[model samples]
Target: MSAEEVHNRISMLRAERGVSRKDLAAALGVHYQTIGYLERGEYSPSLFLALRIAEYFGVPVEVVFSLRPFPRLGSEVVK
Candidate 1:
């Protein structure tokens, strides 16, 4: 079976938290470059790693990773 592309908000979350890729990588026990690869959508993380990332950010896993593309902020229309 083919693997699907996993979408994530790592970069946006990092920026919002003022966390650096290196710091996040270290916290996740992964190479710093891996964080960059994830942010750029060049690599898909394992479920374990995904959970760890969410834990690091103190959010639910769905908040960090999604099967569908997340909508951009301010893209929603109010009724």
Candidate 2:
């Protein structure tokens, strides 16, 4: 099976809001590392957390997360 395609382009949103990680963490009731991980795309949040993040940013969950087809992996695949 292919892995799910995930992208966490949150840095731009953070910058646009002018809020620090610590602040968001507090608002989200998670550790600062959680925010760090999320922003880095190293973590995929649960539905609740995704909703919290979207609410924090005043954006829709669809804006923060999306599903796309995973790229095939093999020599036959095109770049």
Top candidate by lDDT: 1
- In model 2, what are the clashing residue pairs, if there are any? none
What tens digits encode model 1's per-residue C-alpha lDDT throughout 1-79?
2268899999999999999999999999999999999999999999999999999999999999988889988778641
Predict model 1's lDDT versus the native: 0.94
Which residue runs of candidate 1 sit more than 4 Å off their true CA positions? 1-3, 77-79
The lDDT of each candidate is 0.94, 0.77
How far is 26's C-alpha from truth in model 2 (Å)?
A: 0.5
Candidate 2 on 1-79: residue-level lDDT in tens?
2375566546667888898999999998999999899877778899899988888899987777766522333646554
- Counting clashing residue pairs in each candidate, in order, gives 0, 0
Cα error of candidate 2 at position 74, Å: 31
